[model samples]
Target: AGDPAAGEGKVAACAACHGSDGNATAPIYPNLAGQNVAYLENALKAYRAGERGGGMSMMMTPQAQSLSDEDIADIAAYYGSLTP
Candidate 1:
């Protein structure tokens, strides 16, 4: 796995909606902290590949597009490391 701390900056855009702590202020956005790593990684991949659809699909597509496999792994680790 890559460094979780290094992925924090790349994930800053997510914090705007998901919150730095992953507790989204908006009810529509799901909380990401403590989410299952495999689930989170799969969802991101789905969004990037357009296999998922919803408001989040568009939002996440672009975000996930630039992420490498390692980036995804690190991000999943970072969020999974957080407490709800």
Candidate 2:
């Protein structure tokens, strides 16, 4: 919902896994590009809260747990701004 430019830096690490544009290089990683911002935000919060899980959750759970709400917003905005 905020300026997508502000989120660019916040997503550097994410680029390694999700690609700079949020399109994943592998099928194992879910593509984040062009997803709804609200959905991304909620999913991150759910992962952080340990309310979602499976084998794949291990990677996201710890990452999301360390993210602040602002980070979540920025990251969501960044990916949501991209073209899926």
Candidate 3:
């Protein structure tokens, strides 16, 4: 199982734009609260691999690159557990 506790700190950087609870304050940023873990994992990996990001999304590439598989899973689990 993903460790939500660990993810809390791992996702702190994301909170700046995605919001502390995964609900982005900016409309341009997609709300990640209650998002699917598989989807989040894929997106994060894609962003890291430079296969799915463009424009503003590209900005996330560096952050995603810093994550390991475990971080992705944990962060995905944390955000997925929230209400959308």
Candidate 4:
């Protein structure tokens, strides 16, 4: 089973833009549901490290900054577990 508490709080920030169901409201935002874990992790890492450049890169940098490696892994797992 997944950690519901961490999923709730940690995913709260993501829900605003990504939606509670993981479908993005805008075309500019990518939908994360069912995406590959490695892909999600690499994207987050890229955004956090500024290797990926875009409006999302800026918005995600601060959010990703405070996340531990485990936190990222869990989130990737959670989102990847969701259905698109």
Candidate 5:
């Protein structure tokens, strides 16, 4: 699994849109907080693979591309730990 503490430091880029606590800063951005880890991981992996398109795919794909599996897991953990 992943360590929330470790994930915290890796989410600086994500915070701009997703917020530090997994909430979205803008209504157009989806809230990541309180989402399941599996869903978060799968969605990010899909984005990285370019399997998911539309909406923010153009932006998300590039962001996810630089994340390793461990990074994904950690990020998922961090976001999952938050309350919606």
Candidate 6:
């Protein structure tokens, strides 16, 4: 139960890599559009907790660290609502 409208307002930073609509700006970044909300939530949480490790983790970890639970939910909701 996240507010997609509220989530839209919080995605400015993510737009640089993930694009405003959740599609990635480059091939290196995975598109978040239309992803499962649970998956997005788990991934964000893992990144924030430093439990996810990989090439992307180095970048995502720092980005996710500043997000609150509500923020994560909202962001995930926003992305999940988009078309892939």
Best model per TM-score: 5
* Cα lDDT of model 1 by residue, 1-84, tens digit: 746686576678888888888788699999999888889889888887878887768788888888888888888877877899
lDDT of 6 at 2: 78
What is the Cα-based TM-score of model 1? Answer: 0.89
**How many angstroms is residue 21 displaced in model 4 relative to the true structure, after the best TM-score fit?**
1.2
True lDDT of residue 40, candidate 5: 94
TM-score quality measure for candidate 6: 0.96
Measured against the true structure, the TM-scores of the candidates, in listed sequence, are 0.89, 0.90, 0.92, 0.83, 0.97, 0.96
Q: In angstroms, how far off is 59's CA in candidate 4? A: 0.6
RMSD of each: 1.3, 1.2, 1.1, 2.4, 0.6, 0.7
Ranking by TM-score: 5, 6, 3, 2, 1, 4
| Candidate 4 lDDT, 8-83, residue by residue in tens | 4578788788876779978888898878878888878777776877677778988887777777777777787788
- Model 5 lDDT, full chain set: 0.95
lDDT of each: 0.82, 0.87, 0.88, 0.77, 0.95, 0.93
Model 6, runs deviating above 4 Å: none
Name the runs in model 3 displaced over 4 angstroms: none
Q: Write the per-residue lDDT of candidate 2 for residues 1-84, one digit (tens) a residue.
A: 545787887887778788989888788888999999999999999999999999578888988988889899988998999998
Could you give candidate 6's per-residue lDDT for residues 1-77 as a string of tens digits? 77888899999999999999888999999899999999999999999999999878998999999999999999999
| lDDT agreement of model 3 with the native | 0.88
List, residue by residue over 1-84, the lDDT tens digit for candidate 3: 677778887988899899979999799888999998899999999998888756667679999999999999999999988898
**Which of the two candidates, 3 or 6, achieves a greater TM-score against the reference?**
6
